[model samples]
Target chain A: MDLAPLALSLQVAVLATLVAAIAGVGLATLLATARFPGRDLVDVLATAPMVLPPTVLGYYLLVALGRHAALGRAFEAVFGTPIVFTRVGAVVAASVGALPLVVKSSRAALEGVDATLVQAARTLGAAPARAFVTVQLPLAARGIVASLMLAFARSLGDFGITLMVAGDIPGETQTASLALYDAIQEHREAAALEMALTLTAVAIAILYGVGKLTARSARGA
Target chain B: MAPDGDRPSLHVRARVVASHAFALDVAFDAPPGVTVLFGPSGSGKSTTLAAIAGLTRPAAGRIALGDEAWFDADARIDVAVHRRGVAYVFQSLALFPHMTAAENVAYGVSRALTPEARGERVRALLGRLRVAHLSTRRPATLSGGEAQRVALARALATEPRVVLLDEPLNALDRSLRRELAGELREALGQLGVPVVFVTHQSEEARALGERLVVLEAGRVTHVGTVRDVDDAP
Candidate 1:
């Protein structure tokens, strides 16, 4: 019945979703519009997390952001703490897991916008970036919102990667999923059941919202 | 020397090797006024306009508006689409579906204009197109003729150096097409910029065109006064 784990999960998930949404939309736009060498390679690498085992992804993150790595060293120098084994680490892990969902859905959404409309904006004295902001982004918004919701849901339920990257330190880094695991291990059946039900209900609500947005966008199109 | 020496004319020479075994190689000059790019489907009329607007790159070409060169393959000079100051009314109309008619027209208004001046210009344009009553309405709510007018209004709002209209009236009924063709001709005549109007319909071409450039199989088959082209064997 402890609420601390759920609160921490909410905080981490919100931050993770923000990170994922920004990076995901940017990558999606580049993939949808730009032609460049290694474009497919970039797409594959971005989408790798979705199919890669969580443990493998966790291992990569650990290596890439570990205390000995330059990124981790730089983080410590600026923030006076290493990135791993912290709530920030939980955010990073969840963000990585959530990114491919955002990217895939957002890319589809952006690509669905009428190319002629963008070209019209270009002809009307709008720079390419201006046209994207004023025309393409607004037209693709509902689907992008749905993608963000999916990402938030994914961030909320992240388990294996969060466990590996942000150790389940009691009261500090123990998210709902981690705490549920601890509860079941300790034979706290009621607590485990309650946490499981809560996570499932939240996820279902988010998915239902996503479905509504997607359906409306399809109809609108 | 050309008769209209003081007026800016769009001179285009292009060779484009398009996909699906299609190739476009054409050259012509559009003097100030309506120059109808008359051609059947697949004759690359839209591609010609696109090249002039910098929307499509030609394999080899020089597109110059009077003294300013918008694109030159040999010179490796290609002005960006927005920078080229070309107003294009696409075949689909391409109105910003999310915006109201007034907002759609206002979008291309120059940033150098003050907010008050911008709003006034948008209002004047909508009024001129006779779509002032539909300013707050979205493209979905507008009838085909209404939408066409709004698209024309949006194109002219840019005060472009040149105007390109690709089958702008084709989607309307015959009566509406005739009605708008006159309005379109009058609207474009006042701009004094080189206007390239594309259409496969000879009637629409005759109704709006002063000069005509006929395209067949991606090549300029003829270029002359509308009367001369119609009188040809």
Candidate 2:
């Protein structure tokens, strides 16, 4: 109900969405462009989370980053602190849970780039890297933008993963979703309703902006 | 440099295989003049142009210029498309929708040309192609003929050893195609390079090519002058 928890949640979501979107675009570009032996398998792996239950993803994070886990131990040794039960852990959980959205959308976008355009670039004497940067990447920008926005929305409202991995630490890790839950648990209906309304408005506005931008890009082309 | 003078500027012998759909297995040559490849739909004319442009790799074969080899079987030397000095004007024109006509043409020129020289070359080429007024325009705004010229200028700007044109006028209407074919033939002659042109129209092939290479079912059916094709059909 307090603005602090909501604010912290927004920060975590923004960071998680950014990292996830970058990782997703990179992975998707590889999947859509490269001809590696197991590239199809890589696509399947990226898309796995899209179909997987968010709670199951949260469960995996719990196993990987819990204090007794190997990853947790490594983080502890490197930073003298564990990630789980902290804000850092919340971002990791959110990113993992939302990763598939970015990958699948970006791949679809990249695939939409015409092979004829690529061949044309090649014939015009553009190297592979130059062609990708000048031709393929620019054309696929709309898809990447859409994916990033979707990932952001997904991160903004994440509940199960953050609760499982970060344990809803107040002021530090307790985000808007967690605050809403706590208010409901305490029967503070007014506070919960206010938070929910604000969250909904912000998400809608951000998504609408991204959608308009993508449409403009398509039209401009 | 068709060094032997009797030999062609470009020669290719290769087999390219696509997954379950197409395989372009053929050998051909284009001397220092207009050489057209003619075929029906799905007859692999475009595939052959792509192979010559080095956009598609042949299964096992050789590609050679007049004196130097672009590709060799025993040495396994396969030059990248850009480095091969072969320009391709695709069927769609494939003009960069974002870039202006001048910029698109300048893309193929290397650092050897000064910025002024590059600009001059682009302007001169656009003028020569009779699309100079559209120099600052993007592909998205241009007419079909304008876009085609932009693509042709882009291909010629590179000063390639050989030029590959895949159904260059296929997208145009009958009237435009007829008008442009004569202009295109003149431009090809001016470029002073071997042209590997592809067309579905037998008349177009005969009109543009000094030599006509007919492709049927992914194989080279005839390799001779236009008169030879007239005799066959």
Candidate 3:
């Protein structure tokens, strides 16, 4: 069986996880610590992707990052290529789909850190950002790592948004899930089963790792 | 100018409505010595400390260290907590659990110090607090008294202009509390900065206080020397 789809999926998932993790942690920290006028609205928007239908999210992404949009135009200007129907589009879709998991989990982890410890740090001459980096972030590292694994799993299996944004171009944008779907539609049972089992195994491994991290953190706490 | 000459006094006059039922309206002065904020639970002793430290904003009041105003609601001037040059040992002794005792102490030490100087300062503070031997250990492994000393060491690491201790020894047993109280007094006596020590225990207050500010139901009941307050009719 051709492994192009698996290779492409891994590449996209890795990039998507990196992008999602950075944005997710930042959003999570802001939500956990700061109070602003539109705080709740920002939180709702951050979490909308998780609960919204994939098609809805896909349509939104298309509108927001399509050729006519500012972000899309900027990207095309820089890279000389449109974002939609490309591997870059796959990464963006997966990152959006996986962002909520990272944000929710990371926010919980950050908030779990003792508020008094942060106060003590502040009183001990640490600025707010310094206190977060030295105390809160270290305390919450385990949960954040687990969140990253969950994000990776989500990114790897992204289908509907990826399909809508990236489109299925065989050997290019056709990721593992898309390949599995294509195989079954063509009555290729062996190829379909192989892809299904592989994805399942990888997901299970990631979930198991996440569980261990969570258990370790619980015990440490 | 403060009567104490070069050493500044902490002057706090503030009103905080913690909730519909609990409002703290207090005013007091802490000169360059231990000034015990004596009150029962829920009397707002800790809240008063927080307000001075700039962690809690008072609705309308002013907090000043000598000539410099740390917080002034009317003037709209509130120094951020870190820039206030105030060190605080919380009631829970909020040591950084992820750091070793030495690292925790070093954390507040001036970054202007070279790494070696910082290490030396941490060592000296821990040694002075009698927690030097436990420097390699984390807070979780330390006993209550040991953790208390480590917390005190961390607070003093910065050589703050003011120090706030919120019942730092309250978690210890009576005997340990007595033993550590003496050490705390000796350590604080040498600082020459205004020290605000909070406690609900009358004994602890008397043991450490040079001046006493008593609170009852979020209002200042009395402010006098320990002797004056105790000797009152």
Candidate 4:
């Protein structure tokens, strides 16, 4: 069978993981540290995608990034291409699907850091930014890494949202999961079986890496 | 002006209203010597140190180091923790776990001193604290007393105007505590900065405190020289 679907899936998931790692870790730090009115509400909203149905998330994304929508128009103005049915669309869908995993796990990691340690750094003449980079971030790094691995695995398996936004365009938008579905519909059982095994192996390897990272963090703590 | 020419004093007047259990309503002045905040646990001794170090904001107070105003609630001037130029040796000995003893001490030294000065200061302070052998070791590898000395070296590396010791020796065994207490006293004497030493142990207070300020339930019960407190009821 063609390997283009597998390549496309890898590209989408890698880009999505990068996006989630930066934005998700930042959001997690904010949730773990800052306190203000309705902070709990914002936290719930950030993690809602995890429990919400993938189709519902896809529908919302479609509405928000539709060709005529405000945000979609702005993106088109800059890129001269609509987000819908594009490779970028798949990346966005996978990133959203993976975000909750990163945020929830990384938030726990950040909170596990001792408040007294942070205070000690401050009183030792370290500014807030310096303390975070030198102490808090390093202390929480293992947990963040484990969570990112889980997010990458989750993004690779994303089907519903990716299908909704990127659609089936072979060698472009059709990711491995979408290709597997197409192979099954066309009665190509061998191709479907190969894709399924490949996906399963990739998922298992990622999950095994995540397990090792978490074990290391627990021992360090 | 101080009697010793331009030698500036540290003045702290704070009224921090927390719950009855943790509230702090106290004030005292410290010259260039060890002034112990002697009290039992939960008597707001640590709170007072935190307020002076800018880790805790007081409800109404003024904290000044010489002529520099660190915090003044009425005047609405509160310096950030780093800018206050106050160093602390936390009771927990909050050493950076990722860095070696030398790196931890070097952190503060590198911030304020030139590169050459930082190297010299780190070497001298670590040698003084007797942690020169453990310079490359992480905090987890060090013993409790070793960790405490590393914390002290890190604090002193900044050459702070004030040093706050929040029960730094509490975690050690009795003999180790006594030995380190003597070393700490010597170190403080050489540094020439006003030290706010917090301790619940009466022996430590007597051993290190030139002046004693007693606290009970968030209020200053007595403030005097060590002899004055010992002579009182």
Candidate number achieving the greatest DockQ relative to the actual structure:
1
- Once fitted onto the true fold, the runs of candidate 2 whose alpha carbons sit more than 4 angstroms away are A217-220, B1-8, B19-22, B229-233
Q: Write the per-residue lDDT of candidate 4 for residues B1-233, one digit (tens) a residue.
A: 34334667789899887665567889888888899888878889988998999888999989998788899998999999988888898999889888999999998885546788887888898998888999999999999999999999999888888999999999999999999889889889887778999988878887788988898888888998776555433
TM-score of 2: 0.93
> Mind giving the per-residue lDDT tens digits that candidate 3 earns over B118-206?
99999999999988999899888999999999999999999999999998887899999999998999999999999999988777877
Q: Sort all candidates by DockQ, best to worst.
A: 1, 3, 4, 2
The per-residue C-alpha lDDT of model 1 at residue A47 equals 100
Could you tally the backbone clashes for each prediction?
0, 1, 0, 0
What overall lDDT, based on C-alpha atoms, would model 2 receive against the true structure? Answer: 0.84
**Fnat of all models, as shown:** 0.95, 0.79, 0.92, 0.85
For candidate 2, the docking band is medium
The deviation in Å at residue B8 for candidate 4 is: 2.2
Per-candidate Cα lDDT values, in order, are 0.93, 0.84, 0.93, 0.89
The weakest ten consecutive residues by lDDT in model 2 chain A span A212-221
Candidate 2 or 3, higher DockQ?
Answer: 3
Candidates 1 and 4: which is better by DockQ? 1
Q: Tell me the tens digit of each residue's lDDT in model 4 across A1-221.
A: 68999998998999999999998999998888788888899789889989999889989999999898999999999999999899989999999999999999999998988888888888777888888888888999999999999999998989999989888898889999999999999999999999999999999999899898899888885
lDDT against true structure, model 4: 0.89
As a TM-score, model 4 comes out at: 0.94
Summing lDDT over every window of 10 consecutive residues in candidate 1 chain B, give the lowest-scoring window: B224-233
Per-residue lDDT over B1-233 for candidate 2, one digit per residue giving the tens place of the 0 to 100 score: 46435544788788888558778789987778888887788878887787777877778888888767777767888888888888888888888776888888888887588899888888898999888998888888888877888899899988888888989798888888888889889989887778888887877776777888888888898888876755432
How far residue A211's Cα lies from its native spot in candidate 1, in Å, is: 1.4
Q: Candidate 3 chain A, which ten residues in sequence have the lowest lDDT sum?
A: A212-221
* Model 4: colliding residue pairs: none
**TM-score of model 1 vs. true structure:** 0.96
